[model samples]
Target: MTVSITDVARAAGVSTSTVSRALRGRPGVSDEVRAQIATVAAQLGYTASRSASSLASGRTFTIGVIAPYIGRWFFGTVLDAAEKVFSAAGYDVLLYNLGTPETRKRFFTRLPVRKRVDAVLSLLIPDEEEAAALRSLEVPLASTVGGAREGFTVVGIDDHAGAASAVRHLVNLGHRRIGMISGASEPLHWTTPLARRRAYLDVLADAGIEHDPKLEADGGYTVEGGEQAMTELLAASRPPTAVFAQSDEMAMGALRALRRHRLRVPDDVSVVGFDDHELAEVIGLTTVAQPVTGQGAEAARLLLEQLDAPDAEPPGHVQMPIRLILRETTAPPSPRGPQ
Candidate 1:
């Protein structure tokens, strides 16, 4: 026979309702009583039915995670770290990958995740329409790798600051003609690409460097895109002496492009990238390193806290720190090169 809640309650000398509250992690019971009830339930091999518990507590014991592309290094790392935290807390994860425009449209239109999770975690910033749809669900929401929305808690690094730091490094190395390979033009409200680009331009202006539109290229945050963008920049009448790629993958692509064109790195053009991917050290690529895993874990923790106490104070934003990693990829522009 299956062990029931009644049996556990009788063994622990508590009412069935008290056992239910304690087991569900609700607030009507003392810590000592809850611990005793858990111990008794474990000893008796008693497990509450999820359906019945959901009906009683109005919670699904699950979290819904939404991301653009999980295959990318940053997204993959963040999702993995967040999943570990949710699993340890006995919560299930439901992932939604909106990698294409069609999928994004379908997801926002249908909102299939409604009422299926205790909370939602977004790894990317949602557009206005998407944000509205998410808010309609009325669930606790949080984000990582994006700016704070009106109703959602956010955990991420300062994109503008990171970009500014990269530019400053290049400037300190005597690079005046700097170029940038930025993300593709989509998800205009995502803010990462926009903020970074704005900061890059601002830093150049402040440093008294002429900002040349011809030096900018769209890399789409990928290796192949970076290579293509770098090639285009090299073909320009006046190529920049230093190139800052928004991501490490793109930076690697720039290196390949330079080689293909018979242009030596640093010797011909210096390179810097953001998001210190695992290969950065192996390739000696200079980059801005942010706490990718830490941001995910912290976002998960914040959402869990909100779920635990919905009536608690409003959740605040978390800004993780970033640093510039110096490597062999960046140096003073060689005098032998045309400046």
Candidate 2:
């Protein structure tokens, strides 16, 4: 015979409601109580019926993830991590890729994610209109790789601190003529990579280095865009001695450009990248390693917390740590470098 909540509660010496909350992994029950309830429920062959529970609680136990570009390595890595955690907790995930401006507008204004999931998770997504749409949903919301505003929970690296560390590393390595490849254009809310650029500029100014507009190029967060930007910077009369690409893929593209122009890395032009993607280690590229996978898991946890208590606490910012990985990609400039 299947064990019902009544049987589990009787065995665990708790109320039926407590047994239900403990089995569902919801708050209000202590970890010890939850463990005891689970042990008894397992011994009695108790299993939850999600459909019936949804009918009783009016919650789908699902989360909606909104990503601007799901194919990118950074976003993909984080999404995989989130999926693992949510699935393990018996929650479903719905992904929405807003690739075009029109689609983004529709998603925010018309077809906002509603009634489908109990909460929402956004990956490095930035837009005031979109934020407003999420606010209107009345569902718990969280973001990864960016800060939370207006009560939306967030889990991400401190971009300003991380960018400062990256630049300081290059400066300590005796590099003064440094350039940067910034992310795509966004004038509203500050995106992670965009904040990185600002941090770079602020650090350069503090170090008494000139911020050359010519050397700072826009990569548009694509390999081809990085290639084009590197090409333009290299063709300049006075090129930078070191370059910082916003993402690993962009740095890889810049590497290709350097090779085509007979510019040897660390000898002619040193390079650094962000995200510390898998290719970074393969190519021996120095970069800052953000906890992409861990960030995803933590974001899911935060969203679940909000779902349990919509009025528990206003969402706050969370900063995961970052580390600077030194590799063969960056070195001091040669006496006679590419000129």
Candidate 3:
């Protein structure tokens, strides 16, 4: 037989009311007590009765998390952070993986999450129509690592500034022929790829360097795409002296391509990446660092704020800062190069 809520409450030495409060993630329960309850309940194989709770409170006591892709490291980090936050708050999480427009349309048009979750947390999906459709839902909406259409709570980094910082660092190192591997094709609407590319172009123009179409490559925000774009950029008869890959994964791939071409990083060519992923430090890659985990937690907290008080202040945008990590991958152009 399935474990009963009363059994869980008895195991945790709490009353049925306390168990309900802890399980519903209702306010007034201490974090420690809630954790204890959750542990005991799990040990007893106790699952919350969503139907019963819905009948009583009209809430599923669940939060819906949507992301464009779960395969990316950054997106995965955000999802994990959000899950932890919601779990701590006594709420179950429902994940929706809508990577393409068709899937997103079907999800919203179908309203599959109806009566399933209390609020929806979208991670950097910025399609205007999708945002509109989601807003049509009666539930609360929150976003992390990107913005929404209008009247939504969003937490994300300042992509334009972050990109400018990365490119500026390269320019400060006297790199004039810096090429970019941009992420223009990522499904996420508010991703920083195109902004970074724009920053690169703007900085290059500001530095009085002629923008060369031959040097830039569309990397599509993946390691393999970066590797392929890097290969193409390196194959030019007059290759760029430096490159600013938009992602650390891409930078790693660029490093591989450079090694394949018998070129020494920072000696023959300077490179920069974004995100400061773990591998970036291991491989001594220069990149822009954004607080991804913090963004996730903050977005969850904001959603909780709305949940706690429905008639509270309206949601607004929150932009996180970025820092440049100068590692061994970036340096002045080689003396033998085009001077």
Candidate 4:
């Protein structure tokens, strides 16, 4: 026979209402009584039905996680870390993948999450329309890898600082003619690409180097895109002595492109990338490392805090740190290169 709440209540010598409050971790139950009730429930193998619990508490105990692309290493890592936290807290995760503009439009128009989840964690920076739609849902929301908005909490690394750090590393290595491989300029709502590109320009200006638009190419933040962009940069009349890719994946592609052209890393061309991906160590990619997984966990925690106390003060922004990791991919510019 399946054990029920009544059995737990009888065993703990407490009323059903008291047992319910204790199990839900709500107030109005003494500590001793709550402990006794919990012990009795566990011993009796009693498990509350989630459906019933939701009906009573008006909480689904589910979190909706939205990401632009789940296949990407950063997004996958964040989702995995966030899942662990929510699962341990007796909450389920519902994933929504918005990989294309069409899918994003459908998701926002449908607004399928209504009454299905207690909170939301968005991995992408929403545009104005997307932001308005999210607010229409009236659910507690938080974001990772995005900028802070008026009503939503955000957890992310300093994109501008990360980009500046990459450029600084190249400049310090005596590289005057530097190039950049960045994400495509489309999807203007995504702030990371814009922030990083702006920082790269500012850093170059600060180093007394005139910015050359010809030395920059959009790599689309992919290995293939990086390869194509690197090819274009190398074809320039006066190519850069070093290149900074916005992502390690792009950097890896840049490495491939250089090899194809019979160029040696740190010899013919020094390279740097952002986000210390797992393969960075194996390939010796110099990059700016950020806490990708930790950001996800933090986003989950913030959402849960809001769920626990719906009337609490508005959530604030959280900015994580990033550091440059020295590796073999970067060195002083070769003397033979153009000064």
TM-score of each: 0.89, 0.87, 0.86, 0.93
Off by over 4 Å in 1: 5-48
CA error at residue 335 for candidate 3, angstroms: 0.5
Ranking by lDDT: 4, 1, 3, 2
- In model 2, pairs of residues that clash are none
Tens digits of per-residue lDDT, candidate 1, 1-339, equal 899999999999999999998987778899999999999999999988888887877889899999988988888999999999998777899999988889888988999899898899997778888898998998889998677677899999899999999999999998988999998574535678888999899999999988899999999888999999999999889889999999998999999999999988888999999999888999999999998889889989889889888888756678899999999989999887655
Q: Which one wins on lDDT?
A: 4
Separate clash counts for every candidate: 0, 0, 0, 0
Clashing residue pairs for model 4: none
Q: Which candidate gets the maximum TM-score versus the true structure?
A: 4
- Assess candidate 2 and give its lDDT: 0.83
Q: Over all chains combined, what TM-score does candidate 4 have? A: 0.93
lDDT computed for candidate 1: 0.90
lDDT (Cα, tens digit) per residue for candidate 3, span 75-117: 8988988889988876888998888878877887887887778
Kindly list the per-residue Cα lDDT of model 2 for residues 87-117, writing each as its tens digit: 9888999998877777777788775568888
- Candidates 1 and 2, the one with greater TM-score: 1
Candidate rank order under TM-score = 4, 1, 2, 3
Residues 205-310, candidate 4, lDDT per residue (tens digit)? 9999999999999988889999999999999999999999999989999999999999999898999999999899999999999998899999898888888788
- Error (Å) of candidate 2 at residue 36 is 5.6
Q: Distance from true position, residue 291, model 2, in Å?
A: 1.1
